[model samples]
Target: MAYTLYYWPLPFRGIFIELLLAEAGQPFEKKSPSSIYPDHRFDRPLPGMAPPYLVEKGGLQIAQMPAIATHLAERHGLMPSGAEARAAATKAILDANDVLEEISQNGGVQMWEEESWGEFRAERLATWMRIFEETYQHHGGPFMLGEEITLADIAALGLWAPMIHALPPLEEDLKRHAPQVSALLGRLAQRPGLEAFLTAQRARDGQGYCGGEIEASLREVLGLKAEG
Candidate 1:
């Protein structure tokens, strides 16, 4: 059965699924809600009107990032085989997803008002990335979770790619504190399959979905005023 991804044309949460597919070297059909008018803005695509949904075996549709990620990981043998490792991978992936949700909601930028909520969000992001760096340092061998690349590593990269673009400070943080992560991210992007995906995406849409280009998008989305 061919895998089918139902998502918006934009990266959003859908990139995680794309990463999994690319890593597994699986061929799947990409469906954008926008391409279909009845899809209604082509935005959300869940039973409860959520998105990042997937269909397998032709008709089984699943929603939510974690759900879809786990489903794909298990199906494609991307997850660890050991019970403890599997649990850890799942937990780490879900934690990364939680951070992605929080950061993405803030319009993927540092342009939000510096109020209590914004401060809290920024702090949370800092804490999450720090923890992630440490965790990767501990569990990741050549890759997060082991010498082999697992769903955990893919999830981490998927979440970090956009967040780092949105928060430029993250690049500096990665260099200073998480050089491992920075290196891993660079390696992931340069992987033959992943690089093809990145290049194809850039060719198809000039808008940067990777970390480097998201900064400008953030400025645009937040409508930042020019500095004197």
Candidate 2:
């Protein structure tokens, strides 16, 4: 039985899970978050505040992107062997999650102001990029864990690819601050399965990254024309 995923119609956290399933050539069913909100409250497979939920064929339901990612990586042979290596992988996923939160300005709890946005781009965002770059360099290669393309690599791609794709200006920041991470993204994007999945995603979303007012605020701060 294929897995089932619950997420909004955006390529944010959900993309990480999709990339993993695509790389492993595993099939999954995608459902909108609204499908479980008929009563104005989440009718989730498991109790969770928000989505990016994964329901396994064996009746195990999991929430939280990091937990779901680790579960899928372990089950699909995408995680590295041994406790230490697995811990590293988990760290990478959590790091990716943190970066997402930071970029979204804590889920857009406060809209980005020009001054704050500038500061974040120059400092915090640059630091996050360097962190990913240093991780790739420490591993010594194309993949995050060195030679093998594990979920760490996938997580990195999920974190940056959509961001760069949607906000083309940030591509320069990534290329400059995290050249190694940028290259890894290029390599990962070339994978046949991942490539096809991204192609379809782009066709459907058209550079729509993390949809909503937060995204609009982001685009504005970047001086890009407001998206519809």
Candidate 3:
């Protein structure tokens, strides 16, 4: 199947969907930034406000990171069978979206100041991370949903890694406060295809977070040369 992904050159939000594709061992073509539809075109509302849309070979178009990842998971076996498990996994994807918004308050237009960073670290950040961690634990897994990798694991790990990169101070505490989450990252990093995707993306200089050129968190994890 030919999968075409349209996003800014950066990995930010689009990475999660890409992670699902890579983990499924699927090959896809990433559209270049210059070729992506003008952002202003999507600036109206709803589906019009984002990049990272996907076009499948069958002519189905999907937009939004969570939507795209979940859809792909269904077809590629990244999401497991059974209604409860599927619903739970999709809920986890939404949780990751909430986590993304919490960290990226302005949608990556700016970086965090000291006071704002403190507020995030103190309350919302830990709360969001725990939501994911508890879900992982409840599912009883080496992967989310237990025994098999699913959209939840891919989405959560995708959120965790780059966000951790953009905020270096959290690294030490993240491991301290949520060891399983850290352990999960370690495990996911070992997956050959994902590791390669991350490595290749990070190697690109100036690959911004949402194209803002400010996300500094991925270097340690992705070996990113992009400016912080």
Q: Write the per-residue lDDT of candidate 2 for residues 1-228, one digit (tens) a residue.
A: 489888877898899999999999998888887755444334555556677878888777877899899988998989998787687789889998998898888888988889999999999999989988888888748589877889898889999999998899999999999998898899899999899999988887788887788999999999898765
Q: Write the per-residue lDDT of candidate 1 for residues 1-228, one digit (tens) a residue.
A: 378777765565778888889888987777864443345434433543455667776556667778889888998888899998899889877887787556544444543344634564457756777777787878886788878888888877887765555445457755665677778888888888788886775465444442223434444444543211
TM-score of each: 0.78, 0.94, 0.83
Root-mean-square deviation of candidate 3:
4.1
lDDT of 3 by residue, 1-228 (tens): 589887767667778888888888899988864444564444323343566778788666766778888888999988888998999889988887877675666575656666666776778878777777787778846987888878888877788787665545567766766678778888987899888877777686233454443344323233446564
Off by over 4 Å in 3: 33-47, 108-111, 205-208, 213-228
lDDT of each: 0.69, 0.86, 0.73
Better of 2 and 3 by lDDT: 2
Q: Candidate 2: where are CA atoms >4 Å away? A: 37-45
Evaluated at residue 159, the lDDT of candidate 1 is 76
- lDDT: worst 10-residue window of model 2: 36-45
> In lDDT terms, which candidate is top?
2
Per-candidate clashes come to 1, 0, 3
Clashing residue pairs found in predicted model 3: 42-48, 165-217, 166-217
